[model samples]
Target: MRNCWFATPGIARPMSIRCWSSRWRRMPMASDRKLTAFFLGFAARHKWRFLLSVLAMPIYAYLVAEAPNVMRRAIDDGIMAGDRAATIRHSLVYLGCMVGGALGLVAQHWFMQSGGIRTLTHMREAVMRHILGLGRAEYDKRPLGVYVSRSTSDVEAIGETMTAGLTNLIADTLLIVFIFVNMVAIDRKLGLMTLVIVPVVVVVVDIFRRILRPLYDRIRTVNGTLTSQINEVLGMHGVIRSFHLQGAFNRLFREDNDEYRDTNIKAVSYDAAVFSILEGLSFVAIGGVLLYIAVRATGTEKALQLGAVVAFIQWLQMLFPPLKQMGARFAILQSALAAVSKLETVMQIPLPVDEGTKSPENLNLTVRDLTFAYNKEQPVLKNVALEVPAGKSLAVVGPTGSGKSTLIRLIVRQFDLNPGGGEILLGGTDLREILREDLRKKIVLIPQEPSIFEETVRYNISLDRPEVTMERIESICRKIRAHDFIQHLPHGYDTVIAGEGANLSMGQRQLIAMARALATDAQILIFDEATANIDTETERLIQEALDYVMATRTTILIAHRLSTIRDADQILVLNHGEIMERGTHDALMTRPGLYRRMYELQRHAIPDQ
Candidate 1:
């Protein structure tokens, strides 16, 4: 199969050695460098273009600053001075500057937006790879929707900051500076007087930030929670409808929706107040500047020129909007930062550490004192141990909560072994010493709930592996007795499977899974109740297929049906995480132990078997 780093969400395989390499190790956490260094890395890849885009901002700002100055000259040196030709020339120059500024915007957006898209795409892929690389134990810690939000909405939030928010913020800051410089050049007294409001504007922005930061963070959190709840409910759609839980789910969604609404209202109220204050301050600065001009008119110094006064008013008009938008821009920044804070937590989740390089030559499986627990106080598997010799089959029969599935998971290294816990070995080398990719090539696990993608039957079976040809797939399917049913489908092997195989029966999914596993030609095979919840006729066909497949492979079978493992070389009865009995099936049945008792109970419960 063509192993993909970006695998289907439900389909998983062992990770490659590259997953542990320095490529991912170099990613900086938000707490360590606060996303500055991280985002800079993306820009660094296209450094020249990013730099040029930023340079365009200052040029655009300069043009904007010069436009009003051009107007000032046209009014004073042309109109007031009765020079119509000079006025027309200055007016034409103003038009050229505006046009140049417009072109600068287009160029800036093209460069900046392209880089932003590249950054967002890389971010999404990294987040998904990291999430997929996480141990099964880590998956147990959060909902699927949280990861979805991190990769989709949260990443887009950061992208918005990069493309729309950050670029404009830089332009606005530069324009503000240039406008203030022009104000001073026009008249130092009035310019310094206008500067008096700088401290006040800074104070207002600071307070607004202090109030809105937490609100933005809270909104993001609530939004993620609501998304999670919706996903959870949707996944349980069948169960919800069967149980008539519409009203209950409605109430839950309503509560979250109300909370989201309330939080947004609070943010908007404060945002509106801050924005209005900035607008009011701009007019106040203009009023204060006019008052200064009036007072100075009575002085001995030359009277303020009508053109300069008009230009000063125009500068305020240009200046205050960017300042007012500064708050809205900061709001976008806060949203992005909130997203960064959330995604950083995800990135910080340590990937499963594997430093193994060894490859096994034999498939001998061994376990000594194997123990595990999801909770510290509650051990799921106590000091249990077993072995399956090369080319031998070991059947494990146990009731629910007997650690049967956990044992299978441990064999595949789904969850990391606990410290001081027992170890597993293959070919006399510790299982941990084998590279995960190499180990995956040696083993095939068929779980009860097989993951079926929305792809053709052939693709599902071969997984696009170059070696698993069409002839081989058909041969394997025929051996497993899946070909008969598959051929009856709309397009035979080419028929597309629905999501989770809803179009196929449980038996057919298992058959396809068996075909997939056989195509791998793995040395070690594990069946974790693969035949459970299937029809008797289908179960019999699977057993026949298993009989053929298990002949030359090291096999471990966990079964609730005692009859399925009757011909196994050995059987182990496990209870409460401990093996209660171990022997050949006939030998176990001959005794009055847990194995014999369970076998008898199943024999009577399902009499046909």
Candidate 2:
């Protein structure tokens, strides 16, 4: 009766991912138990309907076998015995069973679909939560394409396995088994003769199927590639126009399109061959069964009765459809398996930073002998050390790729992984020792590419916090220059934004992001190159928000434009993962270092700076 499914390929859930502890602990990896259990749990709640449906199966099977018996009674007990009334009665009884079977079949199909969809919804929600709960580092390592497929196509493939697959498998398997059992029971020799064709059919079908599968898979891959081409071209339409490379882009598109067509045609040809072969073999086998039955049948009366013979023929015809359908769905099954493999690989990658189990109690912030690199061979930051006094602002300046943003990420615990490393401490508290929930409240990172969800601006900025007042929102928006745009629009603050705030400009989006960070109201704030994309008009407004943000919080400001951070309590110059210099901005500009050079260049780039 457990409501949890623990069948993740090979990955352990993050401790934070456990919504239910007892059920979570029972997760079983590397076994179908979790998968089977998931189904049982889904079916158990609605078991009464399922049980009723299952009961219908035997009735279906019995009626099927009974129809032949009725024909036998009509011929032997009625016609041969000279009882015409019995013949009519048996005929009517046979018709009634068929009608009942048809009704039961409808209910049975409905039940399977209902169960499949219910399971699909549950799994979709859980996977969505798991993806959402995954820390930033995991998201960075994977592509948007992968997550998109996981949620849509991949999950759908698995859902097919749950619903359509479940329905077909249950009906085919049970029906096939029922036929086999009854067939052998009635006449062992004839049944044995009919089964002679099974092994040959199975072997031939499997061989052709296996040969065709790879080509089908290639067709899928090529189609996805074509889709990728379209996405890339459309997403970068502005860039393409700027470069004046429409012809070149067209050429690339043609090549991908051609490849897709070629692969698709090849798969189609192979699939045609498989079905054609199945067709030829189907008649051969069925005809041979009839030959054997005809040879073994006794005097016309003693031989397999006409009714049994008709039912037997019907059974033979029924078998081919299930067999062919199972083959057709093989691709879906394979796709689900491959998706599981990819999902497993991702879940196995260790998250960059593992939050420890210790409690966080201090407000003191310090960095000591910090070292980090994107790769092992070349260090981006080396032997660096710095400190931020509680509630003070520290600015970091560096050239592009000089590791300034990396420094801020380390401080705010953005990576969540360990290989490319450094350590950050606050109030004698190692950042990793703090719980993630606590860390979110205490430390916040506002990235340059801030995300804007497709929702009302109020919902996007206020983040469902009931305490956020209209006055507070208006104040922050004004400070970030978003107030002008918000008020100018017809709907103002209540207007909804879609397509990731495509209705607004890039600068407008960043300002709204600033509002989001401000709303978090964390104790520590780090902004990594956040103001770079804002317009000159909005830059000053964002700076006002920054001023308010740093007044009573420990702040780490990363800047290429030095003017924004000149008033910072301390400025650290970072180079090659090392702290080359640290001092007040005015003092460092006079000292002949990277800070002075960056200041002069930025003053030219932005006259105000």
Which candidate has the top score in lDDT?
1
TM-score for each model: 0.84, 0.82
Q: For model 2, what is the alpha-carbon lDDT of residue 322? A: 54
Find the candidate with the highest TM-score and give its number.
Answer: 1
lDDT tens digits, residue span 1-609, model 1: 112121212213222212111111122334546666666665577777677789898888888787888888889999999999999999999898888877777777768888888888888888899998998878888998799989998898788777876887788799899999998998887887777776787778678767866776677678778987989898999999999999999998899889988987887787678767877887887887788788889988777888898889988877765664565555566667667767878988999888889998688899999889977888889888888889999999888999999988989988768888989999988888999988888898999998998999999999999999999999999887899999999999999999889999998998899899989979888999977888788889888888877785788888878888888998988999998999998898789999888878878888787
For model 1, the run of ten residues with the poorest summed lDDT? 17-26
Please give, for residues 1-609, the per-residue lDDT of candidate 2 as tens digits: 211121111212111101111111122346445555544654576676566656665666566545555666667667767888998888788788678766666666666667667766765675676677776667877787777767676566666554544544566566666666667776777667667656766676677656655655565566667787788889999999999989998998788788767865665566567667767877876787677678767535357756566656656665565555444344444444554444444444554454465556765678777777656677667877788877899988777788887777677666532543556777777778877677777777878877898888888899889877788889878765678888986689888887878898766787788787777767777888877877776677777767877786788888756778878999888876677788998798787777787778778876765
Candidate 1's TM-score reads 0.84
- lDDT for every model? 0.81, 0.67
